[model samples]
Target: MKRRAQGALEYLFMIAAALIIIFLAVRYLTRTSSTATDLGNSTLENITQELENAGF
Candidate 1:
């Protein structure tokens, strides 16, 4: 009975660790995506302004 409880506890720990890793990965991806989108938008706006100034 003691061995069974130990095994169950280990399983729970593994599951918890996996969840934490997955959460961190998702968060990192979301931040990276947001930063890329913002950079692209800023670049586009700068180009548009330049073209307008140049009479294009």
Candidate 2:
């Protein structure tokens, strides 16, 4: 029936939207994690340089 077809279409749309959201979330998380890692590495390097300069 036409109603059944409409119901199927709605379900497909919802699934597609959900997938897009999930993809965006994963991308955001990856970006944030990389940024955090870069910051940590920079901090470590600075500390190491400071320690060496102090004659450690």
Candidate 2 lDDT over residue span 1-56, tens digit each: 99999999999999999999999999999999999999999999999999999999
Whole-model Cα lDDT per candidate?
A: 1.00, 1.00
Residue 20, model 1: lDDT of 100
* Residues 1-56 of candidate 1: C-alpha lDDT, one tens digit per residue: 99999999999999999999999999999999999999999999999999999999
Error of 2 at 8 (Å): 0.5
In candidate 2, which residue pairs clash? none
The RMSD of every model to the true structure, in order and in angstroms, is 0.4, 0.4
* Shift of residue 1 alpha carbon in model 1, Å: 0.4
Query: For residue 46, what is the lDDT in candidate 2?
Result: 100
Q: Who wins the TM-score comparison?
A: 1
Error of 2 at 38 (Å): 0.4
lDDT of 2 at 52: 100
lDDT accuracy of residue 25 in candidate 1: 100
lDDT of 1 at 6: 100
